[model samples]
Target: MKAIYHILNLCSFDVTNKCLIAEVWCPVNDLAALRGALEQGSRKSGANIPSFVNRIPSNGTPPTLLRTNKFTSGFQNIVDAYGVGSYREVNPAPYTVVTFPFLFAVMFGDLGHGVIMVLFALWMVLCEKDPKVKRNRNEVWRLFFEGRYMILMMGLFSIYTGLIYNECFSKPLNIFSSGWSVRAMFTELQWTNETLSTNSLLTLDPNVTGVFNGPYPFGIDPIWNMASNRLTFLNSYKMKMSVILGVLHMTFGVVLGVFNHLHFRQKFNLYLVFLPELLFLLCLFGYLGFMILYKWLAFSVRDSRTAPSVLVHFINMFLMKGSGEPALYPGQMVVQVLLLMIALLSVPVLLLGNPIYLYWLHHGARNQGTYRGYERVQRGSVEDLSVTLSQDMEEGFALGDVLLHQAIHTIEYCLGCISNSASYLRLWALSLAHAQLSEVLWDMVMRLGFRGDTGVGAVLLALVFSLFAVLTVSILLLMEGLSAFLHALRLHWVEFQNKFYSGTGIKFIPFSFSLLQSGLDQDVLIGEV
Candidate 1:
């Protein structure tokens, strides 16, 4: 009904007083098809003459129409949920096809759990063509069915991350055998029974040859399973990785913005605004990312423990505090100070660059008596010119609003670098929480089944196993999946899109017989052909 009314609103009474006339806005490629359809409709209606069509040039921005088929539709809809893409703007949906699932998998990774998700989506995908299933208009089922592809992709990505984490049902798989050796500590160090008994825990020395050969061929070393400091190791790892990924993702968004500038031919924005913004982000956080990789590669196991913290180094760079820790490299002071100065300089440029340029451009126009385009006024006297300048400046471009908007924008980007970097920590937080909860479920419920033996014990084991299954599916898979999906959506919508997406355009709604046929419910409700 809304669609019908919207189309009706675009029509007007014809001068002939016997026909209604309507103007259509469609792509140039569709013009011939549209004319053919009009002629066919006129003949079918038994009109005296065929309908006429004309093309007129329009400079106004047309409604944005992004062509999408079944496989891409779901991903495109995910982007539209945030905001419709502007006409000619690069669609984030293309990239979201992969990033969305990958980020969700980061939070919800679990091989066994992902297998369950995969199977569920696969069932829906296979049954998608069934008429009976299609006719079943349960709205919730329809929503899930529509996104079967997205679900499948997320599940598959989860499997990959889970493999990397080497976790399934909260248990480490010992496929490559353990890397660390307690025996090496005792044998190589010549430790006697007395020495072994005195120590509560033995450390794996990476410096020694036999103690630690290398990383577990894949994923984490299963030997970490036996270590008391596993959480310490895992926490540091996941947190740093979250920052690394977050920085890269945001940088990509800023880089994407360059394309928008090029498309619009707004080189003023390209040089003054975007370049400075990009420089600012890279100097501060991009430098942080570089430091992360540098520290990982530079500090070998020999100095890993003694190596200075990246997080502390960053904080100290800002505070200009004492370098109490050992320098990671020589003459670090000069480089750190230079990068900080460059980052700080980018701030003023971001705050005032475009707005000031606009002000100057408009000011030049007003002084030249060419304000608001080529309506040049002859100013015979200085006093008259002064009056015109004051009026033009007041009416044409208000510098105050531009400054305010730019100030807020500049502050948001700068502070967001801090807060958003912290926001990515949720990736580590949820992943750890999911791992811990799943481990608890296994330890408390599933583990008991393995200890059972007798007839009664077997029965008890069966009951416990059933309970484990229910909890795993309901809490971990379903609930945690929802949580991860929402977080990933937030990351893309807020953190990713805000950097590049303007999203100020309205979506295109084309008139078509196919649409009317598909919208059977709306047609029936209207009760008219």
Candidate 2:
């Protein structure tokens, strides 16, 4: 139909009957407008004219068209980058509006950097609104403007994460510093009480007491800033946080499959595929995660050795024949075994359930004489069922093919669950890199610049500051930002969206006056106008 419309010049008019006919496509929403325009045209022409619009059935796929506003346009672009959703399919852009920035901020969290981002986004938005700038703006600037809202959200989320991390410009805040004094507490070691830095005194340890009792209330304690084993502390915290967040994010994706299943009316798929997938994730990773958090909370750092390491325990559980010495606590071993068994059993159900059900459907259809071998079904009430039968036949519904496809899907999901979970460690890795890099910059450039006040020293300071600023912009803002963006994109596209999104839709390109004019102009040129 689209092809015929595209080559409409080839359509002939029946001059002998004094009638002209042509097909036109318009949006379903604008059917009334189209009818009104035809009526207006008939009246203007002062002749009795008639037109008819017929609803044509489509066997082929319909184009995807997303309705979006300024806020959602950036998210729509991100969704498009993965793949457009098919017509009437679930659109991922609305979800991406929140998830994409939240994920990005998880990796890019830093109070100072987030603030800088917010300011930059604000500037871009302001520039976009300025008449002079808007008039002269290049594509690059326009692109930035288009994504200003996304940037603002990203920056806002970064600030939230940064607050949770208790870091600003790679430095911990000292708001709670007055609660403790290091030298005073350590006076028994014959240390000078007056000289120790305020940060060095504060402690995250709940056992410690001075002006205040227990650990510093929020986000890493100020003492970690000056802790001898800061990297170890930060790495442990960041890695654990990443794992927890990853599990939650992926589980959320799995939960979304329920909606997709319901929307597509695939009840068998919902029960067979989504339920098993969710159960597998929860049983293995989710139970393991719970054990990890329990270990962290229940056991003191010094007594950590008393508990089995989650990672080592997982490996040993699978590899070791019998648990000679129990790695899990009390009845946890039994629970672990049960969960493992359930997870294993789910694989076959996930693999075979759908194919078998589909085969049964086809078999029943054949029995009903509704479907005939190698025969094309006519369009009518049974059109959908006929189409399905035809497609199944065309694809060759051999048992071997079904088994192979199901096996592949099962393997992919099994492997993907592991890989996708691990992929989230990039959040920890990137955060560590950003923090370390920020520290290095401060130590190498800013530290030196703060050393002196003389003429030569001032000159040296200015030069080093300039160099540091350039490096900061290049490495932190551009390079790291781009890297985080790509990783976040991957997390959403492959890990998150893969669970629910089909991403098989064609983009909608509606017929318009401009297109019509262009076609007419091309026809004229073809006629040597």
Candidate 3:
């Protein structure tokens, strides 16, 4: 009743025959159904004249709308939370369904923690349509219930990443055949309990026969748990993965920009803007990503110390300094020089190309027969009139303005390429922090229980276990999960989507009889959008 009243208040009356006149916005594709519904309503009212829906051209920009079902609605809302995509432009929501959770999992990975999240999300999905659950209107739970599918995917991917991380509640899982031979060390030393060496840091060289077969086929090898240098191994592995994954994610975004240019029929942008952006990104950051992988393949554990610093090489490339580091591969210096030149060259093209193209196009239009539908004459009073209009058009697109716009865009792309790449390091930082925090809980709380032996110890163990469970769920799972979720959101919005998204389009708000008949609160309708 309230919706109907509000809608009626918004419409005006047709004074001619005392009929109501309402201007409603709707999609072109749904015109047939809308027409049918109007005709049906007219027939039911016993009106002699049929309803009319005349098509009128609108100067206002139409709202952006993407069709979504229950499964996709969650992902769409996630994208919308940042800002709505432009009309008829590229949609990022479909891709977000996969990327969003995978990125979250990279930070939130832990088999036990993931399993707990999965159970919570799974329950929400199962109880989605239940009346009792729906009636419960807690804002936080409602938000969670609406995005239950996203949570489910996040949990599932976390389990996969957890398997790769080989962590379950801060302890390494020995699910697969461990590549390291810990028992072999004991036998090689040939020591009884009395003759045990005081040295706690016995290094197991991978090159030593029978000591290491290979890395565990799945996750990190369990040998790292006992190794003193596990931090070095994990840090290098996670950081490298972060750069590779981040570069890939950003590159995919820039490729999407090409499609946007193609759709809009802007050859200038396709040739001048996106091309240079892609080149500049690949030449510099792409080279960095390539170097990271090359180091792993070129160097083995025995001679790893001899491997050069990737960061120092990258810095020196920018400074144009020849530090004379040993070549990792053939033609290394030549490759670096070429890459740097290409990247530097792309900046000038991006800065000047678009403005120059626009200048040529604007001037060339003055002599053309038809220049944007404004007729021009070489002589007579028409020439003076046409000159006035042409001048107006030219003034609207000033050369200085075009140049300034292009310059800002060029600088943004060049700088964003560097900063966004660095932003991905958050993945490594979060993963390490989560792992360390979980480890602390186990060592500080659970370790006490295991060390005790008497009756008081049994009672103490139970209390300690309770505390561990509370902290793990409340702090690690809930708090850390939320933190990862927000960071993932930032990555998608600022780092990934910024390559393509403009978010200038308004949102679609179509009126429907179903909405009126459903008797839903205004808040419910708002939430749906």
Candidate 4:
């Protein structure tokens, strides 16, 4: 029936001969299987079947067929949501598999929340096998079932990040906290302050004399959670971490372009386009990133004269113009000069190289046509073919037009590189919001729940516990989960994918029995079943 439908679409009637003629396009590799099927059908029908197969010359773009299995299907769906890749272009799905979940985890980290997500994903996976569930009327349930594996992986990655953050439901674990306590050391020092607050008790540095033997080896020392300046400490740490991760993620995206250019065999593009883009990014934002790290590591709290905020130093670099004067450091003047020169040089190379290259290419092809005469042109020489094919594909490229397009592209990339790097900071922003919201919920409701034991007090405590749980699930799990999901998606589509993906391919639609069956009357199938 599938074959018959395809034939019907292209069938031509031969009235005198009482026959039909048809044409069909099939993959070269599938020709043998198609022939075998035709022969079997002819034998079963007891009719003489005649057919001829010829190789078709490549004339246009072919449909893109993405090969994927159970493990990769979810990631492929994410890729398709942006746009399917062009024929023979590199598929971004494979790269997205690890990146999507990792980014989501960065924003959604919390062991308790991750555990909840994992349980939900597991339930969806289990429910997928049930026929009743497969036919579920709820769209939300259907979506969950479809992306169960993705959710599971995301939950697992969140758990890993959560562990690194030492956060479980906005509370730090006390597993190693007991051994690092400074209460014994304070007593030894004859510091008889009896009413030391939890914050004071926890913030004690182990490095101080006669304190604990060593610091906590794992995640953030749990003590940081209870410190007087906990919020300030976390804010500083998270903001700087965001910048670092942003730089690294964008750098990875730029590096991936190398593989894409190599795959497409466009070495000129690799050198002229991506290399300059990479250099500009590194020299500008990359240098600032190094300063950020240096500030964190070497900036002294006691010596205010030597340490200045990175943000101020960056501004001063641009605002303070002088006769080769070093405003921020002893030798920053030379580094800045070299970086500025390279950045300026790269701009013209990106804007002019492709147009120049194309001009020579087209000029050489025309000369070849003149020398070879009309006979060579009629025979379709390789040079003519190359020029004609490129012209057709690009709708007749001209030098001026190419130059303008290249200029626009270079400008977009240069600006986008700056904007996209800042965009990844959402990872830190959302994570901070989640943590703060969690803390608020705990203080508002859970604290009340823990306070009382008597009849009326117990009843009030129960109500508080109920309210806390409800708020946690609704606000933190459902609301924040969706928010983090969107941010993660934006990072992939705008920042990561823009680096390499062309996403202009037509998706492959194969002729299959299942497609034919689906098109059949549903009522008939129901009656038969």
Give all candidates' CA lDDT scores: 0.81, 0.74, 0.82, 0.73
Error of 2 at 451 (Å): 1.0
Q: For residues 1-529, what per-residue lDDT tens digits would candidate 3 score against the true structure?
A: 7666656766678888777777767888998998999999999999976786878886445678798987899999888887777667788998999999999999999999999989999898889889999788899888888888889999999999999999999999887867877677667756456545676556665676777778789888886898888999899999999999999999999998877776655656777888899999999999999999989998998889999889888888888776677777787778889999998998999899887766655567645743453323221210012223456466554768667777877888889988999999999999999999999999988898887799998999999999999999999988999999999999999999889877656678666767655645544442322
What lDDT tens digits, residue by residue, belong to model 4 across residues 9-121?
55777788765665445677888998888777777777754543556675555677788886689899989898887766667788788888888988889999899889988
Deviation (Å) of 164 in candidate 4: 1.6
For 1-529, candidate 2 gives per-residue lDDT tens digits of: 4434445554457787665665444568988887887778778887665654567876655566677887898999998988877666667788888889988988888888899899999887777768876676688777777888999999999899888787787888876653445555565344453545543543334334342345566667777777778899789878877888888888988887676566555566777788888988888888767877887887774566576667777765566344544455676666777888998999989888877766766777677887544333222211012325567757645767666766777888788889988899999999899888888888887889878889988998998899988888888877888888899999999988887776777677665556556666666422111
lDDT of 2 at 363: 79
My TM-score estimates for the predictions, one after another, are 0.88, 0.84, 0.90, 0.84
| TM-score of structure candidate 4 | 0.84
**Model 2: ten consecutive residues of lowest lDDT:** 376-385
lDDT of 1 at 203: 68
Per-candidate RMSD vs. true structure? 6.1, 5.3, 5.8, 5.8
Of models 3 and 4, which has the larger TM-score?
3
Q: For candidate 1, lDDT tens digit of each residue in 410-521?
A: 8988898788878888899999999999999999989888786889889989998999999999999988999999999999988888888867667787767566656654
Candidate of highest TM-score: 3
TM-score of candidate 3 versus the correct structure, residues matched by position = 0.90
What CA RMSD would candidate 2 show?
5.3
